[model samples]
Target: MQYIRNFCIIAHIDHGKSTLADRLLERTQTIHSRDRKNQLLDDMELERERGITIKSHAIQMEYKYKGVSYILNLIDTPGHVDFSYEVSRSIYACEGALLVVDAVKSIQAQTVSNLFLAIDRNLTIIPILNKIDLPVANKEKVTYEIMYLIGCTSEEVIYSSAKEGRGIDKILEAIICKIHPPKGNLKAPLQALIFDSFYNTFRGVEAYFKVINGQIRKGDKIKFMSSGKMYTAEEIGNLRLKHISKSIIRSGDVGYIISGIKDTLSIKVGDSFTSVNRPAKAIIAGFKKVNPMVFAGLYPEKTEDYDNLRVSIEKLHLNDASLTFFPESSIFLGSGFRCGFLGMLHLEIIQERLEREYGISVITTIPNVSYKVFLKCSPTDIFLVDNPSDMPDIFNIERLEEPYIKASIITQVNYVGAIMSLCIKKRGMIKNQYYLMPQRVELIFEMPLSEIIFNFYDRLKTISKGYASFDYSPLDYRFSDIVLVKILINHQLVDALSTLEHRSNAFYIGKKMCKKLQKIIPRQQFDISIQATIENKIIARETIKAVRKDVTAKCYGGDISRKRKLLLKQKKGKKKCSLLVK
Candidate 1:
């Protein structure tokens, strides 16, 4: 235990965390030179293709430095704000963290958010400046920023370019000397924290855990603190790039336990495990389960694929407990599932995985955030609504409240005006601003989560020339003058197109949406009217003209009787079509 070091790498997206992990692996000789690959810790093909870490990967390394052998356990975590919960859980399992920052970009929004999480967990953080090989790298400015944020000295900060393999040895030496070894009671009753889990067909549910109190061995009976399910440990192993079976896993060690638990629902991340025979008196404190913030209805392109979609979602949820879904029906799209996700990126990844991995093509509705509605008659009565279609009648509602978020954006000072303009259009209120440096600034705003859920991020990136970074956390639901705007096709409401918007801007938004829908909806034999309405009152409307065939054109020189007859027939058909639309 004295020689064991447990730490994780935390940083913003595209900030060289994974690259540093690769360099560390190479320096420790964990992966042979012949088998070297880029972003080695990102095992998922989707992760590599997208150049982001979605899941946390842990590996144990044997490093010999200064003639002393050290057992280094490193966990690489996802850097996106959507997976902040994963980052927090990974930090909870480790004793220390490497705060990696890009020397050119300095510090990003996610970098600060992650650093606060580490500090809150009381973990030792070692600041490291990465990408020093780049010509734009400013070690002096970045060093000052790091010092200002983390309150560390210049000598304490390590500078390295993971791409060039510079300072890799220095980082390793810092981990061995600065980060203290994990402390635990080896003789106490077995207590382990299950930080992550995944389902395997041959082995059943594999639980990755950190032993907190006592040692675990094969054939031991363990019970989950939350589920209370007992299982005999069939295998014990550690990850050395790949799983390596071990006879015993002692305290302060991270390993996996295979208990033949085939039921995936029984296994949960952040659950504690203890000996069934000699149970620990107290369960280890674990992180909270991630709660989804954004929701969308996922319907299969074909109704027959509903069962396949259901099975696919279940299988996907086995690995991602944060994902949630329930049965939902749509008149236009048929029966489907209303799914919840951590954020927009998470929602997109799930859709891509369903289509690419499960071979199930699905149509997703517009994303929405939950709202709170208060009743006029009963002042104290309140209701929470996730779907606009489920909102109560407008006459009965007294006020509506939408979820708000505290957003932090870090970018160059030149783009501040453009960013502020965009925020104002989205009804965002500036809360605070800090000049990190003479040229860079950090802007904080209180904005509606629904506004940001749409095109806020894309627009921000565009206006800032892809130089701005953003991060946000949920705030309380605040009352607002918002109304549910429903889109109607030929007087019939399309529940899938319903959305909540500020009442004052409803007309403009409705007109824009109606015009956009007019171009997308196919023209029918009869005219189709696309209308946007609030509480049965039309706010905007657009029409897709019918494909009319000149029935009387061929009888141009024919008698007036023939022309009258053709016109009469067409008129009758038009009346019938109008009746059907009604």
Candidate 2:
């Protein structure tokens, strides 16, 4: 335990967290020279193809410092905001964190957010300024920014390019000298924290955890404190490039346990483990499950594929424990799932993986955020709603509450005005504003989650010329005047196209939806009337003209009697082809 160092890398997107992890692995000689690769911990093919990390990977390294051998348990966390909860899980299991900042882009929104998380956990922070090898690196300014943010002296800042492996020695030395070793009582009852988990077809479920107090060995009967399910440890080992079976894992050490538990929900992230005979008295502190902010319905493209999609989704859930979903049947989409995701990007990644990894095709509806609705008859009862079609009628709804988030955005001072205007247009209120540096400013806003889940990030980047960095965390629910906007074709409502919107912007959004449907709906033998409605009143409408043939022009000038007969016949046929909503 004295030689163990558990730490994770924290940073904003594309800030060299994974690169730094690779350098650390190489410096420790954890991998063979021929196995050298970029983002080695990011084993998912999707991650390599997209050049972004979607999952957190944990690995163990053996390092020799001076005359002592050290066990370094390194967690390479995803830098994207959508996976921030994973960062929290990683931080909770570690004694220290490496705060990596890019030299060119100083400090961004997620960088500050992750820093606060580490500080809250009372973890020792090591500030690392990466990307120093680039000619355009602004090393001095970023160093000062890191120093100010961390309240650290200039000497404490480690200056090294992860790409060039310049500061690998300094980082390892800092971890050994500055970060405190894990403190645990080996004699205490067995208490382990499952920080991360995944499903395996050949070997049931694998739980990667940190032993908090007691030791665990092969063939020990362990039980999940949360689920109360007992299982024999089929295999116990340390997490190296591969699972290396160890006879036992001692306290303050990170390792993996392969139990025969096949059920996905039985093994949960943040769950506690203990010996069945001597269970811990209480669960780990601050063990709340992740709250998903974005919701969407995923229906199998073919009805017959429902069962196969179910298995695929279960495996995916085991891989991404943050994803929450339940079986639901939709009038428009049939039997499907209403899934909750961390954000829009997370939603997209899940969709792409479903196609590429599982070969399952699905139909996704308009995304929405969960809402708390109260009925007039039962005002105290809160009906949780994530689908717009699930919302109760206006007459029955006493109040509607929407989820709001505190969005942190950092950008240059010149783009502040445009950003403020755009956020205001989305019903965002300025909570605070300040300048991080002379020309770089940071703005904090309280905005509805639904407003920003779609295109807010893209628009912010466009307006800021790619200088703005955005991150958000959920806030409390607030009451708002929200209405259900329904889309109809030929007076028939399409539940898949329905959405819950604030009354102020309902009409405008409805108008846009009508125009979009007009362009998308193909022209038939008769005109199609696309309508956006609230209750029975239509707020917007558009029409797609019928594919008509000029009967009179085709007749040419053969005879007046023939032309008249043709025109009369065409008029009668037009009357027979009924006009929608006369």
Writing each residue's lDDT as its tens digit, candidate 2 over 275-368 gives: 9878889888786578999999999999999998898888888878888989988776899998999999899999998999889999998999
- Residue range 178-292, candidate 1, lDDT tens digits: 9899999999999999888877779888889999998998889999988888899999999888899998999999999999987767878888999988899887764776767
Please list all clashing residue pairs in model 1, or write none if there are none: none
Q: Provide TM-scores for the models.
A: 0.96, 0.96
Root-mean-square deviation of candidate 1: 1.8
Off by over 4 Å in 1: none
Off by over 4 Å in 2: 549-557, 561-582
Evaluate residue 278 in candidate 2 and report its C-alpha lDDT on the 0 to 100 scale.
82
